[model samples]
Target: MKSKLLLSWWNDLRLKNKLMILYFVAVFIPIALTNTIFYTMTANYVRTEKIKDLKLSLEGNKDNFRKTIDSIISFSTVIYTDGSLVGALDHTYGSEAEVLTAYSEVLNPSINRFVPMNKQFYNAYLYTDNTTLIHSGMLNFIDRETEQQDWYRATVAPSRSRKWMIYTHSQPDPSYISVIRELDFYKLYSTYRKILKIDILPEYLQNTLFDQTFPGKLYLLNPQGDIVYSSEENLPQRLSDTVQQDMTVIFSVFDGVDYLQGWQIAGVYPNSVIERSLLDSRKFIVYLTLANFIFPSLLILGFTRSLSKRLGLLFKGIRWVQNQRFDLLKTERANDEIGQLTEEFNKMTTRIDGLIHDVYIAELNRRQAQFNALQSQINPHYLYNTLDAVRMSCVTKGEEETAHMIKLLGRGFRRSLSWEQDMIPLQEELEFVMDYLEIQQFRYGQRLLHNLEVDERVLDIPIPKMSILPLVENACIHGIEHLECQGTITVLAVQSGTEAHIQVQDNGIGIEPNRLVQLLGSLESSRSMESYADGKHVGLKNVHARLKWHFADDFKLSITSDHSMGTTVEIKIPVSLQSSDDDIEGGIHAC
Candidate 1:
């Protein structure tokens, strides 16, 4: 029951709302959770890799420090085992001059040669207890003052032959790493106590052992955990004092060398530095999540909105159908089932409307037929009788030309009033035009002149009734009527291959270029007769429209004119021949 109710509530919601809810539950929530999990994993992986790299860096620094110390110890060993240096320091000098000779020849040369060879060794000195030897540059007498110093006392301690320590020689001088060894290598000639002291260059030690490229503080700690060398400037000397609670510390201990057994290389990395490294990854993840959410949400919203709009239009169309409105509903073109339904709906409405229109048109045409039949009987007979009586009266009064004009007028009326056919032979059409032109000549006298050129082969070709008459009428009224001089109207008809060409030319004041353009444009328009009821080129448009309806694309009508030259209206139509027997049969059938 609960599931059914939930489904019912869900189904009651609009399409857009339903899609939004689904997106929130399915796409939005899942993507957010997945991104959070991925970000957490990425952060953890970066931190683990960073710690591993830091450990490797610390080990490398430790190895480098040990190597530097071993080089110093090797230099000291070389001096300790030297037999000449031992003999020099142990010799009992008879006089001060002899001591100076031994010092210049032996001790000074040895010290100068060895010290300059190693960049790490700062200076080397030998201390002896012989009071007869003078205290000079490489040779020093072990006096009461030296015995009291910390490095000297440490070196002279029992059972200890070598030691490395940070020491200062005097007050106000910076400290150096000093290595001291007791010179007891020759046991048989050991007459006096001798010591060797080698001080290492502080600058060389700092540069050789520490790496500045590491992202955190680095320290070289002594046996007592004191910072003997550091990468940072002005840092405290003890490791405990320099480290903070927010720092992560990693260290590597020195092994295999007895002197540097307890020393370590420690790297102190702040937590903020690790977080800074992860900043770019965090930003990328956030941007990816936003893109995933925003793009799909917009797509779903657009899709649902379009679907709902189309459905709404379909519903509206149904309502129109319910109210008996059969007009076609305009809709967007689509290829979906909904679009197909809309198309079928429009088709149904059109068919229904056409059926109702047909019924109404059939009734209207029946009524019009009755009115035309009655009109044909009364109007034509009355007109013919009046015209015949006028002709006879003119003949009796010796007005022969007037009688002939009246007879032509009567023939024109009879032809126009006969509504039996919409098409007539080319010859009959030209005859009617000739009679009309004769009447116009009488009206205009010497001002109007006309000529006709016909190809006898096409005289029997059928054309729309009254087609050529309108062109002639326009030439007389619009063309010749405004001219000061005589106007000549030429009618030409010819058969050219499978087509017939007819032209009506007038030598009169031609139309302006702009007006001619409008006239040509009006002829091409397919507007209803009512729309062009008050238009100037109605008759020309009517003839063109009738020709187009009869021949479709097989007919052409064109007008060309130039200012003060002349205007030519030409018609080209395909020839469709019919035999004389068919015409006779059609006539008899019609009668």
Candidate 2:
């Protein structure tokens, strides 16, 4: 049912409209669908890839941070195992100077060597309860206040099994994640009581924990969720409150148990940065969409218009042929289907024109032969007998002018018999009419006057024989023949741009307006063989029809007359119809 409706709609549309619809369907729709799918899949892929990349970078930074803590633990363990440091801490000095010598040799040398060797270290200190044994790197007198410190109590606690604890030290310099260990190696009672503290620089710890590749705030929290370090310098100390406020925020946490137990690194990435990265991808998608859809759409539109324009020309040619206007030719410039169709149309018009020409010439010849037969068989013998007797009698009475009129009459009758030529030069046709007018002048005497003004350049133009002469005769017979005063007839032919204008003007009794209109209407409507040979205005009709058919309607004949004034007949034909010198000479021979 849908197919039937679509087919009906398609049939109702014009060819160009149908082509545009098809182009949108076949070309544009698929492109749009493909771009939509590609953009969707690409966005998914890019988001997934970005998340994976961020995860990898965060993991790599965590590994470096864990390694730094492990290195600090390893250095503290090495310092703890040193026999010299342990012996020095356990020694009972004989004097203060002796104690200073032992401390300077063992404690100061060991701590200074390690502190200067590592940029990650802030300082190292050995705290002891022996006030009399003073050393450069050791806290010489441990008081009750120092014993209350967190690192000091954590290190000295008897039940503490853990070898390392992260704590801050403020003595020589503030330190982040300081490793502290109690120094107790003697089994018997001993006076020396000490603790070792290895300090780590906060800057080094931050550099190890955070990565520039991961664009966001990173927090290093202890096992109890206290933020010990953060990438954002201006961030508040309480990170849990910040995370809880905005639910849209996405973050990841890594617990550090393999290397530095009870530590967690949390990374929070801002949505704006992710959105900005996606915006870049969206821009890329838009560019791809334009390249994929817009450019091809323009190309398709151009192709569709070019096809429709050529088809439109073909349709116009068909319409012209249907209207019987085959003279306007179609040009085929391409070797495509439409061009081939145009070529076929041009060939058909040419064939039709050839057929029309052949038929028109054959009909004209047949009509001429029929007219000649009718005249000769019906009235010629009697007319010749009557005219010859009158001519001889006039000669016998010494009326030379009357005899000359008879001779002119005979010449006219004979010239009318020759119907072999269809076209004649303007020069010869005018001469034929002038001879006939001279005969009429003999009868009218001074009452009839005529003038012929023809351009020399147009004299040799080949027009249909008897085309203008008939108009001249009509002007004289119907217009000037019954005038009271001297009636004047003028024939003019001159070039008017690309056309030749030939006019016959008479100053005599003119036709009534209505009659003139009716006569012209008859000439316009009359195209049949019967109308050409039968009407009272048959000569004019024949001239008009012949000029129209010969010149493909390029020639026009106009008749204008005013009652009691005059009548004028004008003919305009294209200059292209003018014969060349050779054609003019051939036309003369034919005439």
Candidate 3:
């Protein structure tokens, strides 16, 4: 039972639901796969790129720091070489106290204050080849070791090349290097003691290094493999072996400078620096993934919703029409392709309705035309000859009233043949019919009675003019003419909605049931060869044709007869008051 229900549920999935499922598989899945593969590749590439950029940035920063330090060292030499300052320091006096006092004043501010302002300058010692180590800042006095340092030896370089050179002193330190200067500013304890040492602040030096933006670990090393300046003071003293092998990384040893004194500004960065660069790539990946999720879903939903609404409207409209409720008219939509289809559908329906209406009108007109021709065949030639003979007889017998009645019979004949058109107002048509009945009454005055009953409101209702006259003619002629007793003809014009009903009933010799059936059969099929020339049913046929023409299937003509009672012929005509406007526009009679 559970399995059957589940199967039924699956079968019940709507079209849109099935489409959404397919979309997830066919479109979204592939897009996701493509993006995932691309994202994965990009993530790896970002890490590699980061490491490359970091190494390059580190190298550049290191070189820039070297150039700055070189410039500052060179400027110091230029200052010392100023003959005035040199001459004052070398101003010979046996005491040397004046020169010492002058030097003290120049060095009064602690090395902590200015020279190596970061407090990173571990030591500053003034040295000479003869005096060895003399005055020291950050230390009271220095020993022969200061003279033995690379800074001491490089200044008095054996080749005696340039006035100054920068050196890295990583001596007894996780520290930085200092510059050695051959000063002409020394007093004469002995003329040979000439070198001055300044421990240049590595941090200050690094700060002044580069104009361009960069990131790296910057360091200055002293000659004795001691680090004097290092951006990473807390990095582990022992590095992993694999990391140590990397040319960009330094573990324990102070890597030798490629130029200058064995100590130099060096930048070290490992592959780990790539982490930051990968972050930018990761952000982009996130954006693409979000687009992947949102973009296609929105596209699919919008497409389905738009198309579905258009299709639904069309279906709903057709349903409403089928229900005979001509409503739910939708205004045209512009953006979607479905709107065009709906527009086309509307056009097709309009054309079909017009064709159907035309065909209906045509068929009705044909039938009415046939009926009219039949009714017109009711030629009272015998009555005309009889009236002529009566008039002659009356003239001979000196009866003026009988002759006058014969003239009236001739007048009625002309009127019946010439009613203006098929469709006419109710009042005019009734008057025309009454005139013909009056003429018949005059022929047999006391033997017949004719009366017309009409609703006043229906007087102006337009109807086919001769549509009722044929049945009335049958009643007056065939109905009462043969009756021995007094005969009665009643004409009723009643209004129902937009319909006009005219009923003529007679109390006379009624028709036999077989004769009534013969009359009511399809008139075209009953027009037999035997009575082909007689044409007595002309007016009846004309009325039937006119009724069919005007009202199509919505109209009726019926003949009823009872052997004991009487005969009744009813004609119904549907009319519209709005046809006045239709006639004005179409310039044709309203039927």
Candidate 4:
């Protein structure tokens, strides 16, 4: 019973609401939960990896510092054991000139060769206790002030052969990592003590050795735990006093080297640095979560909208049918069930429209038959006899022009009343138009002039009856009736390839631009005949409709006019060469 009730409730919901509920439960909730868990795991993993990378970078810097110190020690060892250097320093000299000559030739040449080979070697000097040796380049006399220095005291201690310490010089004030080695290799020949001090470039140590990709502070501490080198700018002589509790410290101790035995490289990292390292990962997770959420939502909305829109159209179609309107439903090119239903609906509407149209046509034919019966009550022969009598009376009274006009008027009426044939030879249509123009000429004398030009080849073409006459009447009534000057009407017929071209042109006050637009629009509209008859441009609309009924799209009617320069109406129709021999002979003769 519960299952059945649930199913009933589900069936009672609208399609869009049902789809939305399914999406929320199936897609939205599941994706949101999984993405949240995935983002948490990713952030933790990225942060752990960043901390490991920082530790490895600190170890690498420690190795670089060891290598630099070892290189300096190697260079100092060479200077300590050089026999030529020992001989130059131990010589007994008489005057300062002899000292200068021995110093330039022996000591200067040797120092220049080694110092320029490395960018890290700032300067090298030899300090000695020999009173006879002058204080000159690369040779310094060990005065009482030098003996008081810590580096010198450390080097001269009894069994210490070498020492590395950061020392400050007074002349050019900067601290440098100095290497001091005792020159005791020639103990048998020398009675004096000598020391070699080489200063390593402090800028090279600060800029190159500890420059790492990790965003942390690095410090180089000597065995005595003093801050010797730091990567921070404007650091004091000691470490900062305000160390936070959350700061992480990593240490890499130097082993295997006797001089740097207890020295260590220390890295200070903050929690914020680790978080910064995971910034890109966090952004990626956010974007992924949004994509998972938005894309499925858009797809669900699109599907629901498509279903609802088509169903709405179907409901609208049913309402139209209820109101007795058999309008065909427009549908998409789909192979779904809805498309099939729409197709069947359209077919049903088409059949109903056909049945109703047949009934309407039958009723119209019945009414036309009754009207024809009423028209046939009048005797056309009696009307013709009366018109001929009038013409004859005018002739007897010596009114020849009035008699001729009456004869033409009778012929026009007879031609209009006769509708036995719908299609007539082009020659007959032209004759009818000429008769009408002659009557119009009588009405507008001296103000209207007309000309006819016909091509002999198109004289036998079959055209609908009264097609050319309306166009001529429209030209005379609209084009020339209001002209202050004399108006000229030209009718030109020509054959071009497989078509006949006819034009009716007039030189009079032309239509205004706005009015001409309306006239052309009326000709193109698919309005009822009754509406067209009650509105403007009735003659052009009639001619356009008749041409369309006969030839469909094969015939063309176009109007071109300038504001004050005349209007031209041109018609084109396919030429048919199947007229009777008598009609062809008549057309040729008339042309």
Evaluated with TM-score, which candidate comes out highest?
Answer: 1
Clashing pairs in 4: none
Error of 3 at 71 (Å): 24
Compared with the true structure, model 4 gives a TM-score of 0.39
lDDT of 4 by residue, 255-355 (tens): 77677877788888887888887789889988998999999989999988998999889889989888989888887777898888888888888888898
lDDT for 362 in candidate 2 is 98
Model 3 scores a C-alpha lDDT of: 0.63
The C-alpha stretches of model 2 lying farther than 4 A from their native spots are 13-17, 32-71, 87-113, 116-120, 127-137, 140-162, 168-175, 184-194, 203-226, 238-257, 262-295, 317-329, 333-591
lDDT of 1 by residue, 1-591 (tens): 999999999999987788889888999999999999999999998888878888987788778777776776887777778899788888899998998898889888777777877745477888899777898876788888888888887776675534444343333233456777778888589788888888777687777767658788888777776666678776466788888899989888876767877777889999987787789889999999999999998898888888888888878988887897886878888889889988988898888889878978998997897688777678877888799899999999999999999999999877866746666789999998999999999899999999999999889888777889999999999899999999999999999999999999998888999999888777777446563766677678778876775667889998998888889999998788443433332231110
- The CA lDDT at 524 in model 1 is 70
Q: List, residue by residue over 395-492, the lDDT tens digit for candidate 2.
A: 99999998889977866765665656666788988988888899989978999999999999888887877788888889888998888889998999
lDDT of model 1 at position 91: 85
For each candidate in the order shown, give its overall lDDT on alpha carbons.
Answer: 0.81, 0.75, 0.63, 0.79
> Residue 331, candidate 2: how far off, in angstroms?
3.3
Looking at model 2, residue 380 earns an lDDT score of: 53
* Better-scoring candidate (lDDT), 2 or 3: 2
TM-score of 2: 0.43
If ranked by TM-score, best first, what sequence of candidates would result? 1, 2, 3, 4
Q: Encode model 3's per-residue lDDT on 223-295: one tens digit a residue.
A: 4444455556453232332235333553222234333555544455554555566677778878988888898
User: CA shift at 431, candidate 4, in angstroms?
Assistant: 99
TM-score of each: 0.46, 0.43, 0.40, 0.39
